[model samples]
Target chain A: MTPTSLNHGASAARPPAAGTFRFAAHTARIPALAGVGFKHTHLDAILADPDPVGFVEVHAENYMGDGGFPHRALERVRQDFPLSLHGVCMSIGGPQPLSEDHLARFKALVDRYEPALVSEHLAWSTHDEVFMNDLLPLPYTEETLNHVCSHIDRMQDVIGRQMLLENPSTYVVFENSTLNETDFIREIVRRTGCGLLLDVNNVFVSATNHGFSPMSYLMDYPMEHVGEIHLAGHAVQEDDEGEPLLIDSHDAPVADSVWDLYSIVIRQSGPIPTLVEWDSDLPDWPILRAEAAAADRILDEAAHSFLMGKSHAVGA
Target chain B: MTKATKTAFSGAVLAGAVAAAISGAQLVTATDAAAANVKCYGVAMAGQNDCAAGPGTTCQGTSTVDYQGNAWKYVEEGSCASMELPGERMGSLEPLERDMPS
Candidate 1:
């Protein structure tokens, strides 16, 4: 059903202590369990259901407003769940300087909530202060890499915590791209000491969009630096050349092929806190939670494999 | 009715808003006041908004352009139609502009 067709959590009450409320004293970490992206549509369902989601994530821009319903909802949700603030507008990859105002607002939010994990895309979302609002790709040049690492360093310093950089699902390859996407990310991790949020669906989508192997991309990914994982649905449509193009549209269920790739990665990475993101055509809360539960099963299997390996090592 | 199917009958748009009764009338009033205060920020060309523009803006970062008469940005109480906004996306009591003001 459509979001407008569902119950509006509009009637929910603000906590009496909301106005004077301060962020809890400690920072919350990313729980190594399944999570779903926080959507206004699903907030009440989340509070109503005790489904085993480890944490919740939100677009940093969504809650950047001064004060209102969005802020109240997020604060209440924060009281119940650990949060991961995934930013889309820091424009870390752009040649333009980072926005100090945006950083200060972000820092204020992070300070207030003390989120366990803060993340942003390796792509740029703004140009000359006009936000395209889409996560546009970056060229993988050495100069670009150094520039991005510095941006990450600055963001980490301002936020008072290390942030995770996500690999973007690209449609067009830059002619100036000099580094492989994986190594490009590896260098950023090395130079900035930031972590990676591996989006496997992006791996598959970019692989299909370009002529590369998703598996190989995953193999070369710096799994050592991964702190979180994102699995989302994408729209597969043909480009002008009749080649398949997969848009990172988080409006559908996890496809079988992407799930297969996730199965492989969870086994190797031994269960990073995976998230299911359904942003556009959001399904009911149960459907989203079931997807999280499915990820939990994969994590469980990964845990089982790791234990078996440990048993074998002990036996040897 | 099952929560998923029950949504068809109740027309609940979001869960957080769905659970408002428990927070008591203070919250319901607060939410209503917040809803009443949503100002249509006209400068939000394309999808430069958090949410509540119109179709194609079901989520953040989805608006392409040309906001309709139904879009809005949340604002503090009694301040709509007065606050200065950027570009042509001027402030209004309603979220939508009915036409591209810029």
Candidate 2:
């Protein structure tokens, strides 16, 4: 389950302290530490905070402007924090072809920024040229497998970088989906050579919605390809049958169950670049930092366990 | 943790504030009054255009909704609905399925 075969040379020495992340979870060309989703609200606070968090992420659609304050702010912030460009409306899993204009704008942004990590969801958000602001689920079939893989390939070709594809939280399943979600993603990674962004909240949400095990989904997932990890909070409501339906709302702090699952993945994957994503209803700056600092504490513990050759019982 | 990091961070912070000032002056000319109270977090991403009158589907703030290119100019907190520009019949943001899908 170790993302790579790097020997850590175990020592009896314990790690420094919680919230002090010293090493990269997994080594990449752009090494990273604990990161958070970039909200314009936190610009001044982030600029002023001396202890740098690993990186900050931005929604691609937010910065598609040719010339604007967003770009100015982003370019300035990029000086201090490594950036991860996240695409909210790429619609990569849709039946329609990838939007050339969207791709061009994204490419321009990527080219200008040269971000360390760029990611899009496995869910589709656009169809027939109308942009829906939601991440819709995809049916996992051989046809979908081929279609998504080709899209990933084209994206890598145009963007000139390996983009991380994130797992989505689903409410409904298609009868035609022949492959399980994990297997579907594994095939995409195997074929496209793109990386994975394992969103633990999504796993927990979809598993609870579909009546499955989050751990089992992780077991089946191709963990080695995971370049980044996402941790967020979700809202839970009941379905028509009075069943629990989890919504991927990035409006709150990291949930307890999600933090536990993230702990399990960290032990298995040995410290990936994890991000705290809060898109809407954003809290004050210190609250979000507290969440990122909390993720840092967990990552610190996982790295300590790995370094000390202990069982994955750091937080368990 | 290192001196190098602290120095870089402070430097970035200064640069971000300075850059924000420059852009605010050059692009968002109308909102200087609003800028007095708003910080970075107060500004959401260019509020997505609800109708075709919303320009800049390709660009972020070019929406014909508010200011020509500055429809995304930071609106006073809780004042997005009141800030009206020309030819604007604003559509509401679509609500997510809290309990059930329609």
**All-Cα superposition RMSD per candidate:** 17.9, 16.5
Model 2 sits at a Cα RMSD from the real structure of: 16.5
Q: In candidate 2 chain A, what residue range of length 10 has the lowest lDDT sum?
A: A6-15
lDDT of 2 at B75: 56
Error at B81, model 2, angstroms: 15
Can you write out model 1's per-residue Cα lDDT over A46-79, one digit (the tens) per residue? 9889664789988877778778677888898999
Assess the local accuracy of residue A116 in candidate 2 as a C-alpha lDDT between 0 and 100.
82
Q: What DockQ does predicted model 2 obtain?
A: 0.03
User: Which residue runs does candidate 1 get wrong by more than 4 Å?
Assistant: A1-27, A311-316, B1-102
Model 2 segments more than 4 A misplaced: A1-28, A310-316, B1-102
